[model samples]
Target: MDAGAAVLTALCGAESFSAAMATRPWARSPHFFVHYVPVENHQTVLTSPAHTALSTKLSTELPTDSSLESLGVQKLGMVVPKRHARRAVTRVLLRRQIRAAMAQHRCELLPGIWVVRLRAPVDRQAFVSASSESLRIAVKAEVATLLGDVLRRCRSTRHAAQAHAQPAFQQPSTVLSAP
Candidate 1:
């Protein structure tokens, strides 16, 4: 199923921000699903007793660098319920919406690990209060724009490197044969 339609499966199963911080290569962009994994406790969060329980299960379900090779896109999934409704059902729906949004633009997006972190609460009541279809669309557009920006940066860097390396010269005219 497309990631968008497969919202339930995708959001619930995405790799956590903390996990990606430890195991994946990350680039900062304004469009991120931020969390509060402290710099000091990062190691403990990944290895702590309670976190470990979730990690072990997550390791199997979440995509690693090698696994993403098949999809040609990198993605991270996480559900962060707002402190008020941290464990609510509305959070799941938000995640699902995100997945759906990601799936819709999967083609234009770059192939690399993309993290989908959820910061809003998913409690039914919470979602009812704050969720909207447009919010999901806006987030998706922002993410895609961010990814595009990254791609542009990479291209520009490579171009700069190439420009520095090349010797200045103009190509000679080529002879053409007409049949």
Candidate 2:
């Protein structure tokens, strides 16, 4: 397997999809919601021959000056429910928009499986034509906004978790004997 695929396998296991789906949604917008699950360790899984081969292949494919260890692999799935989009073309357009938004934020995305699901239908009355340029633009804009919001929320939550994880120092109690 190629280095990219190997990295992906290491970061996202066989059941990553189900795990991602089960995770509490990280963020939500009017039309889209995002679910993410972080990868804790990649080295522990590289003991298998298949994983070793994949890692070697990835290392060779990586740039001579670059380090693959820093690379964060993530799996992504996009969903456009039929209920949300009646037309197949509309669903395809929405998926394309989601992919575009993901690509734009590829570098900034954390190492995790992410699923972008459409929860609501676009306003058909606003754009009468399913394949209109205006519809495409609107979908793309909404997807971008959704992804941005999700990322922001993820960062905030991570910070909150870290804050909570830190030990809080307590002041020693002072007792006055019947004073």
Off by over 4 Å in 1: 1-19, 22-71, 82-87, 119-170, 173-179
Which candidate has the highest TM-score of all?
2
lDDT of 2 by residue, 1-179 (tens): 23344232222343444456667778888888888766553232222344455354665453321113543666567777898888888888887787767766665566656778788887789878887899998778777777778778767876887789987888999988995
**Could you estimate the TM-score for every candidate?**
0.41, 0.61
Give the per-residue Cα lDDT of candidate 2 at 179. 56
Tens digit of per-residue lDDT, candidate 1, span 95-126: 56556655665544443345555433334442
In candidate 2, which residue ranges exceed 4 Å CA deviation? Answer: 1-15, 41-71, 157-179
- Per-candidate Cα lDDT values, in order, are 0.46, 0.66
lDDT of 1 at 89: 49
Give the per-residue Cα lDDT of candidate 2 at 16: 41
